[model samples]
Target: MAPKAWTTKEVEAALRGQCEGRHRVAPGLYLRIEAPKPGEGGRASWSFRYQINGRSRIMGLGAVGDVTLAAARRKAEEALLLVRGGADPLTLREQRAREAAAAALAARMPSFREAAQQHIESQQAGWRNEKHAAQWAATLETYAYPHFGDVPVDRIDTDHVRAALNPIWTTKPETASRVRGRIEAVLDSAKVRGWRSGENPARWKGHLALLLPKKAKVQAVEHHAALDWRDLPAFWGALAARGGAAALALRFAILTAARSGEVLGATWAEIDTVQRLWTIPAARMKAGREHRVPLSDAALAVLAEARAAGDGEGDARVFAGRGSGGGLSSMAITMMLRKMKRPGTKKPWTDAAGETVTAHGFRSTFRDWAGEATHHPREVIEQALAHGLKDKAEAAYARGDLLTKRATLMAEWATYCTRPAGAVLPMHKAAAQ
Candidate 1:
């Protein structure tokens, strides 16, 4: 206020307090200052106060003893220029901050790993179980995580994605194809979020197919281990002698020829004793279609016995666990097998190809038995097993349930299963299914 400037000594004298005097001189105007406290360790600074548009302003030059008198004077003069230019330096600082924010946004891009996480979160509700989430995380962590997982998604090209996938595409075609599809979904989500623009780096039909061979042709073929329809009589006996959830689940899998998930997720509500069928809801099915599993007398007997046991621990799941929450996990059946500790069973059993077999492979065992042992057409067996049709005509126009044929197949299958190990012939050959 008084000539808008004061010296270090004058300001300090004004502040006659508990410690030695150290003053502040405002850069270009009146200075009000305080002295150092007893333990104030650093050197003293000078400050000046001014006004622009009715807003008070205070500017600091540098420490009194460190800054030469000439430097201090020069800073004050430059501040005068800034004030006269009619620009508020505070406003300019804010504008610079906004510019920095915009620049950062422009340079930001989603990474392949990041985009995938977003995609997984988006589609999580639609998937049937944690397996979908688990598979995505496993494949990405195993494959894509090492490649473009750290690369910016917008910078990724089809070739970059292909390189990540090509190594396993032929030998592990199904897995590779699934990984590629997951990548495509990630990029599409990135595009939606405005972090990406251009053709999807993982698109297969037009782009990847050009670089890689057709998946069906280049894919490695796998074979399933099946019993000689004649050997099934003995296999069933060995399986029957072993008793536990695994033994029971295996028996169910064989009789139904249904996928492992279908059997594991089976519940009492789906089975109708009067109707002699298990109606799996569409959501639980892999083909995303509702299916009817025709129950034979033996299959119904298993259910009736299970229901009689009255161990509906969780949600009335026909094979639910001891603690109530949901049906057996997809691995529930596999773990059940490992628990049984059967001989001639690999610590982890191998397939016909000598690869590890899975719960699903049991379905193959049934289909194999049905085909190699009997005179049934493959289509009939497929209908009995609910495979997606290869016959486009039947797929397009088939409205009938094929329930009668399925019942016959199930009855014969059950008989094949229940036949004692050394039984010379079918038990009910006279009134056969």
Candidate 2:
């Protein structure tokens, strides 16, 4: 027997009565009213009842306040048609809802490129230099961007990261490793901001490690190319003959055994001519600690030349560039080294391995000379080179910068560096012993 279709007045009357029961409106539709309970008002809503494949199901349309009688009838008719076609309307509705939710979530999440840029900006203040930020951006753009940069951060998976890393993983292991780490960092930042979730696809220790060969296994560790200490005196003489801010900067760097960035970024305020000290601030230092370099007469003379060429007062660049008041370019010394010729020969100065000499190689040269040719203690040499003590016990015990001992050691280094071409100094008997 077919139940009577409910009229608008019957539906309103049933809702007003607040009865706890379902009243049929049509063959597959009902108006449900629930009695008030414990400080809550009565409730009225619309529901559709139907059978598909001999299984009966109920689906809520909406509240009485939202679904009108006519609208409820239209919805029920649609559901009845779906039932007749052997499809469950409830399942289809839920599927559409899930798809809509995913689309909205994707809209809210940033692309990998945008997330990477934001992460880099947030971390820039802590980085030692602008070059570090530049390197991060460059590596990601060159490797990761083409593969998945425009993809939403939440959608970035292992496959996307693997595609970016696999090509250069074996060929350029160092760069590939940095790219992987950077991608991991960006994704981590995204997760922290709630823009993404799940495991980091670029993680190396346990995840990517399983997929790729270890970095060390793929390539041997490569040190900077350095001039042999034996060949330094002649090389020094030739470098001295050249006249430029870069040449002077290189000479100062070699004398102090400082890193290239440290040398290139030097300012007049960091130097003290009276005290013979070049104090590098913690912000500019790699170890993030202030280091005092006891300047040699040669280093000071180079400074004097630089001062004569430009303003030598507070905050001025020690090696002023041709561009207004700025420090010399970081590549200045490297380019100078590449162009420099060995004494009386057209050949460019190179390490024993025949690689071109690098500005940073001077630190290695100084360490070799201090260890193999001088009687200076290891810690003093390391301190002069601004290296942190590897031994925690030794480091904790060491309070002083060993200024007096290092001053003397640097003086001796200065003497060796200024020696005439073809002169050979004997190794320290103590070192030899």
* TM-score versus the correct structure, for each prediction: 0.67, 0.70
Residue-level lDDT for 387 in candidate 2: 93
How much lDDT does each candidate structure score? 0.70, 0.89
Model 1 / residue 33 / CA error / Å: 35
Q: Which consecutive 10 residues in model 1 have the weakest lDDT in total?
A: 424-433
The 10-residue segment with the lowest total lDDT in model 2: 424-433
Clashing pairs in 2: none
Rate residue 408 of model 1 by lDDT: 75
Report the lDDT tens digits of candidate 1 across residue range 87-148: 66556657888999767755777577877887888888888778878898899888888887
| TM-score of candidate 1 versus the correct structure, residues matched by position | 0.67
